[model samples]
Target: MSDTTRDGLADRFEENRPRLRALAYRTLGSAAEADDAVQETWLRLDRAGAGEVDNLPAWLTTVCGRICLDMLRSRTTRREQPLSEINDPPSAVESVLADEVEAALLIVLGTLAPAERLAFVLHDLFAVSFDEIAVVVGRTPQASRQLASRARRRVRAAAPAATEPRGRAVVDAFLSASRGGDLGALLELLDPDVVLRATGEAARLDAQGERRGAEVVARYFAGKAQAAVPALVDGAWGFAVFIGGELRVAVAMEIKNGQILGLTAASSPAALAGLTVTPL
Candidate 1:
């Protein structure tokens, strides 16, 4: 391509960067990863040479979509630990969008299988045709549509209520026991097979990736939540820990039969923002 041609293509690519990054973020749920995906798309476009492309926007969109789909697949195969912060600083657009992409929504996305996430993100968020998505996911067009449909249903079902005081009471009780160093009380609040999973900063603090059994779990939190307070985690009972009035940690619980079945701590900015806490 001539200098003019290359310059024109570059301009077009730059014009589409924000949209591409947004699409990738929605699919991968990591701003840094989305930036990487968009960069890779640029590389591919350069190597292919833009002369043959009839619709630059559509072509770029498809390429970015396929790249994200592969990344999602690799993430599944490796069971990669979820990170709280993006590698890159948020641009103005990203910061604005991040606020809109509630922590609850990301939590729900975590539950989806990779293909379902890609299908849902591409078709529903970006308006990519199912036929194009089929190529990325190795599914037929009809199958791709079905995949998105299932994801949509799951997202809808996962929406949080404004309040569930029962959950709040449980979280408060757990926090009180933790602050009081009441191991027996902690054990009483947990199920026999309770599980504790920590991600982002919380995972590093806990040392191990997960802890099991009521005794082990109780010992870990026996006196840890001195600064923790009740909060709504995606509309469920949870707690938040703050330092100097800045939110630092969010704890989300899974309670069943009035006992703690599972709990998660997220120290990432995204997770912290999703938490709804009362004044200290």
Candidate 2:
């Protein structure tokens, strides 16, 4: 392509990138995969004659939708035997909304057909018209609306009660107990069969890969708190982590009923390289 053609495509991408990312994120529920989908969409546009397209935004959306659909279709097969299976870590949005929903919601969304998920996100979340969603999802406008309606019903039926302020207080207490190295208090807050998992680069940095059960996690953090200084993470009341003074590891938590149900610690030096820390 000529320089002018490349420049035009770049401009088009810059204009529509945010919308494309939003669509991908709502459909996939994974920030990293959404980023990859957007990158792949741009690569495809570059290879094709996108500069000649009159509706660049629509063209990009169509291409991105197709790419995401393909990924959703293949996701099951990939999960069955992934070369490197990484769980989707909570993005900032997911973290805020985590307490409002159950793990079952994530599982249900993951099971949705791509077209259904796309239609729902566009119409419900993004407020796109069925006509526009129809184009992206490759369905009739009525069909798109119906798909979105079905998805909405499922979400509503399964939605958990909103997380109350008191629930947040419990989470805060758990963080304080963990930071103070109070093993007894920590155990009191946790359920007996609590399961803990981490993802992204954080998983590798974890000494035990992934720890499960309340007792197991309690022991793990007890050892860490005994050895290191605690630091506040992400400015959230419930977020806390341990730093070796030389390296900063970020720790995020999900608490329920005053128990630490889930914890994610990013201890990889590489993951820590770009982070800024706050004193506890």
Candidate 3:
């Protein structure tokens, strides 16, 4: 690639990185894998002589989607392990999306063929046209639409029953239980296999590599819940704890199956600054 082309690609990456990341995350269901897919997309673009391309953004997105599809295909071979084993444990962002796109949704997406997943994400999630999806999936426009339709039908059939209202109630209950320090109430709402992840400074302090199971989380909370008061983080149900009015920890919960399956607590003051906390 020429210097001019390289400069142009760099500019395009700066402009489109967030959108590309969003697409990959929605398609892959793992933030770490999404980052990998985006990186791979840039590598492919560099190899393809992207400086010569007129539509750098579109080209990058197509390359990113294709890379994500390839990664998803390889992921199918190892489906038995929990998602956290294959990728990083769920983060605050995943917890935010869990209410609308839970584990069931990810499983359903995994069931789809690569082309089908690409078609569906591009068309339904990104609002791309069939023509554009056809280019990305390497199918005719009609075939792309058919692929998306098939994927949509499968998702609908396998999806957990619409749980928007129920999910909201669950979050409310979790907050209530946490504030009251009711371990029994919290465990009652949590799955037996619940997974808890504490990132940034919290992970360093605990040195427990992100707790899992109802019992493990209960014990961890027994210690920290006293120190951390409840508050909302990032417009979702969350808790913010302060030490002498200085942010000390931020907790975010992901509830599924009437239980808490994922909880992420950030303790690094640097990381905490980027997060917005609201009164619970």
Candidate with maximal TM-score? 1
**Candidate 1 accuracy as lDDT:** 0.75
lDDT against the true structure, each candidate: 0.75, 0.62, 0.68
Better of 1 and 2 by TM-score: 1
lDDT pick, better of 1 and 2: 1
Taking every candidate in turn, the Cα RMSD to the unseen true structure, in Å, is 13.6, 15.9, 17.4
- Please state the error at residue 112 of candidate 3 in Å: 1.9
User: On a 0 to 1 TM-score scale, where does candidate 2 land against the true structure?
Assistant: 0.50
The window of 10 residues in a row where model 2 has the poorest summed lDDT is 78-87
Q: Give the Å shift of residue 118 in candidate 3.
A: 1.5
**Alpha-carbon deviation at 241 in model 1, angstroms:** 26
Candidates ranked, most accurate by lDDT first: 1, 3, 2
Give the per-residue lDDT of model 3 (tens digit) for 153-269. 766543442342255456666656766778888778777787777777675535665777887676556434555544445534456677777887887766555666777778887
RMSD versus native structure for model 1 = 13.6
Tens digits of per-residue lDDT, candidate 2, 206-233, equal 5756877777777766534433333333
Estimate the TM-score for candidate 1.
0.56
